[model samples]
Target: MVAPLKVGIAGLGTVGAEVVRLIEQQARTLSARSGRGVQVVAVTARSKAKKRKLDLRGVAWAKNPLDLANDPGIDCFVELMGGAGEPALSAIEAALKSGKSVVTANKALIAKHGLRLAKLAEKHGGALNYEAAVGAAIPVIKTLREGLAGTSVHRVYGILNGTCNYILTRMEQEGLSFAECLKDAQRLGYAEANPSFDVDGHDTAQKLAILASLAFGTAVAQNAVYVEGISSITPEDLRAAEELGYRVKLLGVAVRTAKGIEQRVHPTMVPKSSSIAQVMGVTNAVTIDGEGIPPITLVGPGAGGAATASAVIADIADVARGIRAKPFGRPVEQLRVTSKAPMERHEGGYYIRLMARDLAGTAATIATRLAEQKISIESIVQRHANGVDTALAKGKSSPVPVILITYATSEDAVYRALEAVQRDKVISGRPQVIRIEKN
Candidate 1:
């Protein structure tokens, strides 16, 4: 029998602890599949004394996670300690430099410094695998790096964050406000106490950056992504989307355009008939548009201890079987620095909801502004506010809610038209503009 692959895990948090339990419980099957037994040789955490469900009878303890990285006995280092800095980054660097295979579920670390780490791993004859970083258990990383290697990918987009998805789903299904649904998400433990990372779209941007690198063979550009959070998404916006045969989802999209690579994370209006619109709750779905094939969509649990651990274990299994692939599908040096397509250059349909004064010529003025920018309107609906918010129904004049759906137009044109409308004082407040993604 071949020698068992020794594993050292850092961070015994939810995902980390679950990984240990999974490895122990499925030892026989994992070994059979990988052609080698996998063993948890060492473990480390901030509070080692914290009571855990898994028995750690035989596993050695490392006082510092960096110790496991350099330990000659350990063949692979599983980094579950997430962060863009400190011990997580330092320890992964040490492991890769020492020629030990490294597996991680750290999206921030990967997004910030993936290319550099991939180069180090290649230099030291080690493998750096992060299948768990993007979509937990979705096999997205593997699919882009291996399955679609031969095809040229044109676009990659998805609902990457489960918290935002859950909130949107609840708001649409239960007719609840954003705040109400956010509170429910917090109570259900789907969102964090802060919730800024997930709700503000940074979480999805980080994941999108990583996916863009893999799909487009470009360097990770987190800063290049145009980010727009779901904090401002109102119940009225959801209703407007539903009325137009669309559903609201916070999506991270990356596309190869003539200008360059366009990456953005924002609230998107997807058609009700699209596959991505059907993915609700805490689930995630990714759709890839590649050459020589129809768009392929993969949907599954985007997060959770078990799902993330399952992806981590798959990377470990590949390491156990001596499978070594380039971290980002291609050699790190070959990954080009693609230019970022400015958001202004983006061309798409838009859903604009505005509170216009119920006065003559106001609607005509707004339409004229849009036409001045060559923005064609697909449909425009004007409705009266009957016992709506006091703010909209202020004084003797009730503000009318005008919803406009425009045909494909440059983002610059839409913004310019909205600016003109705002300057003219035809709109009461900031107009809510949501992009329409037909696919």
Candidate 2:
């Protein structure tokens, strides 16, 4: 008879606690599916005295994460304590070193030390699974690592962060400013007190690095991702997107190019008809474009304790079933080292918003600058100023807003044209540029 797979979990926070409850609740289902019973035998947390509504009658509490990880009775170690360094890192290492399978939901740690940890898992012959780290309950990791194993993937992109997506959704639907939506998100517990990690694109960048590795077979490199935040997005931009048949989303995109894989995170203008654009609120979506297969898009609730616990339990089930796929879909020794693709060389469509001076020569100067850089405009709209003729008749000057949609062009050319336009004194303030991603 197969013995129950004993599990030790570290950090009994929201996700960890839920994982324990689910293991007991789903024991029969898990055993039927995995061909073995799964048990949560040991656990540890920052404060064991902190009362949690969990049943630990048969469960033993360890002194700390390391002690729990090294416990001989457990067959699997689950790490829920999140951080890029310290106890989480050492504990996971110790667990792998002991030839025990490990599961975790720590994206930051995976992005930074994933290659190192993956190597340890390989050397020690134990499974290293982190299905919950990228997208909670989305199954994207398995899709890329296993489902598409026979196919060749060229592009992978998504809306990875819930907080940023919620902010953008509120701004587009209700015409709210970034700050206002952010304040409301914090109040609703969707955002942290220090929201820079999510809003500034770092969180998406980390998740992107992990996906890029799985899709492109490259070593996880968070620094390679070019990051731009949603804080620069404005109501006017969202309104313009609506009129232009597009929606603004904070997207993390990784695609193969002639030069190399390009990974970037920023507020992108996606066609309204695309699958990813339809996603809103705290939901998450990822689109993977393979060589021969049609694009596959996975969408689901990205966060919350229940959603994340679902993914963690799935990883544990894989371990119980004796499945040990490569951590990044490839052996660490075979993973290629990748660096940041230069943004100036990035080629794509661009949306440029300029505040032009309401002078006769301003329009002419702007056109001449763009022409000098060999940029072709797909469309241009000059928003009519309220009572502009009356203001001109009264001998006043105001800046007219001009929006331009450009065909395929280089990032350097766009910046050069905008810089020349700025130097010529034809526009007011800095121009806003958003990249366009087609379906």
Candidate 3:
């Protein structure tokens, strides 16, 4: 009989603890499916004394992550300790170099140093699976890496971060400001105290880099993603988007273009009718558009102990089944180097909200500038002046809100026209711009 796959997990946090529980609880099922039993024989964490409430009766507690990774008794190493550098990286590296399969849920590490670790896994003939790195329990990584291996993918985009999605959802549903929703998210343990990583779009950017690499067979590089946070998104923007038959979502989009793959993360206006826009709350969703196939959208809980653990266990099962596919869906050497796509060259419909001065020729000046840039306006709405109808406030000097939906245009042209409008003193404050992603 084939021996069970002995697993050693580093960092017994929420996810690691849940992984152990699932392995024990699902041993029979895992064996039946994988053709072998899966066991967590060894584990390590920052504080072993901490009461994780997990039953580790026969498990060996290693001294540190490196010790656990290099344990000869273990066949698979799982890293739950998150960070872009240090012990997590070195531990994963050691595990890969030792010819043991490695599983992890660290998106930052995967995005920044994925190519190097993938190379090590390739050279050493070990399976490197990180299905939980991008979307927890969504199976998107597998969909791109194996399921869609035969198909050519044109675009992959999604709402990758749960915290940002929750914030935006509450803001849209409750009509609360971003700050109020963010505080509630933090209180509910959805967002961190600093919250810069999730709110500023860095977390989404990291996840996007990983997905982009898998979809396009490019080397993973977090720096290549153009990131814009959801902090600047206001309730007014959300209202305007609703009126325009769209929903504002913090989306990470990577699509193939004539120039190259354009990867970006920002607050995007997706049509209310689109599958992704229907997703609300802290839920996560990803849409993959491949050649000759209808768009496939995978939606699930993007993060949490149970959700993330499911993906990790699935990856471990793949390792147990002796499935050793290329880490990034292609050989490391074959993976092309990806550079930052210039955002100025991005071509898409734009939703521009300008606080135009309530002057006689303000709208005319704005129209002239946009026309000069050859930007065709799809629709324009002069909403009101401080909640009062523009017509009623005849002599009010206060700025009136002007919302414009422009046809497909270059990002540079939109900015150029907005800059001219600002210089001509036709608007007040910086304009709020959201890219439109159609279904």
Candidate 4:
């Protein structure tokens, strides 16, 4: 019988424990398939004795992850210690330099430094695999590089963050404000103690950057993806979106346009009946439009110990079988860097709410301002206190809320027109705005 493939684990956190669980759970089947057993020989974490449920009786615990990375007995280094830099970065670098296969679940490190690391792995003939980085429980990275190798993907996008998805789902379902949804997500443990990374759209942007790098054969430029959070979304905005036959979702969309790559993470108004809209709660959904692969949509759990470890073990299976590919499906030197589309260059429909005075000529003036900018309104639903337009008929000065859905338009024209009209003294509150995506 062939000798077993030895694996070393770093950072015994939630994911680390899951890795152990998976190794044990799938041991018999994995060994039968590979014709060689895969064993966890050692592990690393900050604590030598953190009372945990994961049985470490047969596994040796290493205080320093770097030592485990450099160990000759370990054929693969599985680094779950997440962070952009530090012991995780150092350990990964050392493992690659030593010509050992490396697997990681750190998107931040991959987003910020993927190009350099990919080059290093190639230089040493080592594999840099991070299927767990982009979408946990979904084999998207592998599906892109291997399954869709023959087809050219024009765009790839999804709701990449589960915390953000949970909050948006709650807001759409309960008509709750962003703050209220966030508090509920916190209690549900979907959100971290500090939710800025997820709620602020940075986490989705990072994952999008990573996917874009692989899809476009370019270095991951997370900073290029425009990010806008949903914190400003009010219950009124949710209701308006619903009335307009749309649902609000935080989308990380990437398109390879003729001009450049357009990557954006923001609150979007998708058609209510669209499949993406139906993906509620902490579930994640990704869509890819290719030349001949037929549009593919994969939806499942975005994060969790079991889901995340499923990705890690998939990569481990690759290592055990010696299956590997270029980190971005092409050599680093051959990768092309595409410029990101400017925000003002974007064209889309929008949901805009304006607070208008219940005075005669105010509606006409606003209509003229919109027409002057060629911003044609598709529908206008005017609201009154008693469901009567009598306040305006009586010439009484009152604040009337006007909800509008505009036709698709150019951003430059919208910016110029809104800038001039928003400064009007009669306009109440900053005009609440959210862009609509028909896809």
> What TM-score goes with each of the models?
0.97, 0.98, 0.98, 0.95
Estimate, for each residue in 331-395, the C-alpha lDDT of model 1 and write its tens digit: 88898896657889999999999989866678688989999999999988776656233323334
Relative to the true structure, candidate 4 reaches a TM of: 0.95
Taken over the whole model, the C-alpha lDDT of each candidate is 0.93, 0.94, 0.93, 0.85
| Poorly placed runs, candidate 3 (over 4 Å) | 386-394
lDDT (Cα, tens digit) per residue for candidate 4, span 46-103: 8877876987888887769899999988989999989999888889989999999999
* Candidate 2 local lDDT, 1-439, one digit each (tens): 8999999999899999999999989999999999999999999999988999998998999999999889999999999999999899999999999999999999999999999999999999899999999989999999999999998999999999999999999999998999999999999999999999999999999999999999999999999999999999999999989988999999999999999999999999999999999999999999999999989999998999999999999999999999999999988999999999999999989999998877767777888999999999998878656612222122237777889999999999999999999999878999999999988
Return the clash pairs for model 3, or none: none
Summed backbone clashes in each candidate are 0, 0, 0, 0
Candidate 1, residue 102: Cα displacement in angstroms equals 0.4
lDDT of 2: 0.94
lDDT of 3 by residue, 314-348 (tens): 99999999999999988899989889999999999
Q: Which has the better lDDT: candidate 1, or candidate 2?
A: 2
219: Cα error in model 3, Å:
0.9
Q: Order candidates by lDDT, high to low.
A: 2, 3, 1, 4
lDDT of 3 at 220: 90
RMSD of each: 2.4, 1.8, 1.2, 1.9
